[model samples]
Target: MKKALAVAVAVALTATACGSEEKDDAPQFAERGTFTYAIPADPGELDPANAVLGATNTVLAFAYDTLVHSDADGKIVSGLAEKWQAQADKVTFTLRKGVTCADKSPVTPQTVADSMNYLSDPKNKATLLGVLIPAGMSATADEAAGTVTLATKDPNPFLLESMTAVYVVCGEGLKDRSVLKTKTSGSGPYPLFESVANDHYVFKAREDYAWGADGAKYEPSMPAVVDLKVVKDESTAANMITTGGLNGAQFTGADRKRVEAVPGIRKGSAPDGIGEFFFHQGEGRAAADPAVRKALVQSLDLNELRTIASGGNGEAATHLTSLAPDPCRGDSVTGNLPQSDPAAAATALDGAGWQAGTDGARAKDGKPLKLRIAYQTSAGPGVQAGMEYVAQKWKALGVETELVGSADAKYSDSLFKNGDWDMAWVPLGLSLPTQLVGYLSGPGPDAQGSNFAHIANTTYDDLAAAAAKQVGAAGCGQWTNAEAALVKNVDVVPVVRPTQLVASKGAMVEVIGGVVRPTSIRMLKN
Candidate 1:
């Protein structure tokens, strides 16, 4: 699905904050003002069902509501549904009374059920299918009882947690999906007021809105209007935050120090996966060969690679998925990944029939071993430098490397559509292991599956299948072992864990699921 295809800015700041006292002195709140923040790129689509960009999710939070919500710590909280219970195969949610859609229509159980059912059907072709919500899942609502129950074809351990990503569309938007491309119809904290394609989007807060993560209610401290500005450059965004041109923005580049030096600015940091490599194991790709994959990994010092990728502000990654509210906290990558040994790498490449020619380039059967390293252009200079270092290492092994850079929005096209990349540095920022099943082990891109890497590790598939059957943490062991299978076999490489930092000025907010929570945004005094 789109979740795994795209790399979201996985920045989680606080679990549950509402302009409370962060210091001994409680900060003053403005009567009512506009809150402006910068998104790394333009949120391409407004429809939550088909889009998975962190920028879109940030904007969607102001207009859409999920069945349930989770705190930064992954604790389940009340959202549209006041109370709910979840089993391995089924989850039932009781709708909160007096909730209304943006159109002023009462939100009924049938509406919620319809939204869930629409997202779960594979025929609908919603990108969230099989990733956020399981495929073939069905939802039924009892109008009289004010309850909606969801049942999946197969048992999903994190079904309840997964619902947090299922943004419920109103009946009108579901009927005519075209209008949703540019408008908002769901019941959230704010509705779309205006949008300018690549510039900014404006939203006005709903005065009557009361439902939020962790039972948060709208207050005067909350912004009357929200502005999401598209600022691609991290240095410009940092400067904006320092000069009070913006309320908040996340930075992963060298410019973060500039913002941190400014006084009275609020900041939050959390781990986000970086420098991860996805080797495209397609038919003719150089990395398709296990020997080549092992040799390539063995040729580099991953610890140094991590430092290069994160600007010396990261640690060796211990797991594949690093998004906050992570359910499974296990070390699947410590001893599983290939060790750094240049001699071993040379031997493996030589044994694979890749011989060095006069030009120091390896050729086998008259075809040279070439690698195309694809990375996001907006991932900062650190990622670019790290990828160049990788290119150099592979070049030392007599393999030709080409650095292919793509924008954040078009990176997926380069990986899936162009099908030209040998390896990519996109990190899958998923909170749960079940959410990674579609991307890591399943039908490949040709069959419309999210496994763009074309990984076919039977051990991973079998272990993942077992993990999917267990309830919640009961199957965490299987999930951990499954992730190890991917690393041990060199299907994917988890390189580094970088701390994602977000700076704020004139406002205080919490970032959940990689975007600022609209309700948690509190306008501060001058």
Candidate 2:
């Protein structure tokens, strides 16, 4: 029952828009105005299951349609699945008929089943499938019945929510995964018309596509073209927004005030569901000690951190999961956080038999307390500032922190996987709760491959499993328990929850919704 309630709340938050009282009055764009958007990074892949990076996820969000989708309010809504049901451990979805893929092939239960099967296949390099689809589960289609049956190993309460991540792809066009590097074929409303690597991408709406809500605020207004430009620099992106070079673009902390101050520049923020510093716990003298980790946690001033990290654009996060404005609803263990007292931090070091050295850095047995902290240069300006802030704070606490910045495209994956640094920064999206599996489970990187922390605990794993099986209120306790255990054990430190900012030209293009989703963007002609 509690599980059911939790699921309901989660669905409600994802499907309904927060603070959306006024009806959207933005005029629809002309049938052929090309809406150019600026994105910081280029998408790594067009394939939904293989693209784990945030930029890639952004592209996939626009290119594909899942069985279920969430609205601005975080409530669950129908996508490809018109209706669904669960009985015991089996869940079935009634596919929406008459939907066609980019190849003009009709969307059927078989297409969904085939796509899911490809994802579930261990041989496939699809990382997201392992987390979204449970092991031993198989998808089967019945054309006559117009339904797809999913058989799970356990009473998977989050099956429908999980299906929201498995995008339906055309079985015919997807002969090789490499083709995703250049082409896309899905049952989404938008079609990839053309793509220029690292520069621009264009999507044209499908006239025959019709699977959105009955009264969706914004549909495909510009049916002819939706263009995306890759602008690496925030200043350039902002300039594009102001000069009418682009209709919309995401902004970071440094550009927040500037963009908000621009006349007729509208802004929107969503709880991005990621706020944590990845502690490289595998090796190194300082990081290898649990007491050192606890002291670092105690020494962090969250309010100050929030100000520096977010440039006053975000609030300090007290828990691992985001707060009420988030799509995924779960209680955070903010109270259980180690006390933010520098004196206590010093005492913790003292208790661990570490004494201050001549240089004001902590040392135990003549070894200095020092560790290398890494941050990806491509994570945008905000993250780079946050890393520097953390370094300064740790230095005050008698810890020597070496800041290492990487410019490599896959720097994060390499850093975490190779245990190359003492700490790193990462972002986790809230679209699916099952994303926690890799961090907690000990199978060494299964599917969805990013268990870089290599963190594992039997008790926490059990709790996570139990939580996964619950849907509503019952699941909350389990989720809370798991979170508490993770935090208490210092599995990951909670940082400031950063809001995703999109800078748009208010005069030329009015943003209809509060938080503009990838699929919900529609330019309004002034």
Candidate 3:
């Protein structure tokens, strides 16, 4: 869902890299315990239909249940729906029997249909429009058969896989969506017990919970209560995890080293999140010029930038989708990006009629080459330093640079609504290539699409359209070509895939796209 940050709109996806291994001397599981964790920021919207940030998804995961479940390796398995069949244009999900909502109401086939229909409707304007469920998709229920069939107007090869992210709201929540802001309704292992904005959220496991990934049932070893506290500072979170104040927390910067030093603390790593760049190619923007965009990318030492941005915890990215279990797995970004050569960048800028003055300032037709760059401050100091480094390199190139750093809310507004930026550090964390289409091609903010960059790469668009029609891994070649087209055209730049690190003190944490999966949590007894 870059409902993962400009999720390349606001979400950033990350997958766990460790903690799935079993050892001969594995720790014993506790009968019951409180599994508390940290979220970097507050998840503003609790409604599953409107969740835009990864933190929101993290919080909602406890209360909501998707139609399908993704296993440790991201394989689609049974969730709320037991058995499912997918097609290019449609998917049928057979609901598991004896499932119930938070209010103890039976989860009928219509319950699932209504949730899907709500997202499909244009009037509802759900955030996951085409990301989770395809656009123009409709749902029909066969109550007698205990199945819900979703038919899409456009062909969607990853329909079943995408449904893993679609959080189905219970009938009561749908009837009065406001209730969702403070409570839970869907059937999950845990139900929302309490919620305090910018503070903490608590969930208690359901005693009779039976349905989970692959028919998993609630056990005595699982946490009785899950407490999610919002800790904005990474250092503080690291400290909390080490001292047993928090059972789990993700560390992305200097604090990561602090937590890893604690010998007994469990950790999971993933090359899921990326520190990518998006240029505003809209009319009148300097980045709209392909030469300028290329020059900007070429001016900086991306390898050094990656090291700085990730606090020396990441490697060079080779594709757009940084999240794990990527359906289209391949290297599409390796040779596509412009190599770092400041001199070549200057030459390219000069060739584009941008002349350098006596003070080394570049201008064209008396208009100085000024560019405004913005990034989400929530990404931490490392990211800010990386953005500042970009400004420094551009300054050497005689370009006037303005850096604006804001939190998620303001940054999201600037990207999708105000459009008051030239270049942005917006990483759309997507596991599937089809998810990138809405952000990189098609209509933009004005048309209610996620193309905040206003990119119009026809080559990429054509390739992506063809790729979307192909079913699953068979379209990897086409998808790779489509992504290559975007990079070659300078519409977007893949910087580095940062390693996402989560440290747990007493609970075994499994992260999916940077958030701890509620079902994968188990209290450990040492």
TM-scores of the models, in the order given: 0.90, 0.85, 0.92
Best-fitting candidate, measured by TM-score? 3
Name the candidate, 2 or 3, with the larger lDDT value: 3
lDDT of all predictions, in order shown? 0.81, 0.63, 0.81
In model 1, what is the error at residue 76, expressed in angstroms? 1.6
lDDT of 2 by residue, 235-280 (tens): 8888777777887776655666777787766666555445566565
Ten-residue stretch with the least lDDT total in model 2: 8-17
* Candidate 3 lDDT tens digits, 332-396: 88888889999999999999989999999999999999988998876778889999999999999
Where's the lowest-lDDT run of ten residues in candidate 1? 12-21
In candidate 1, position 39 carries an lDDT of: 88
RMSD of 1: 3.4
Off by over 4 Å in 1: 2-25, 121-123, 171-176, 357-360, 365-367, 408-411
Stretches off by above 4 angstroms in model 3 are 1-24, 446-449
Clashes of 2: 27
Off by over 4 Å in 2: 1-32, 87-89, 174-179, 213-223, 283-285, 321-328, 408-410, 441-451, 454-459, 506-519
By the TM-score metric, which is better: model 1 or model 2?
1
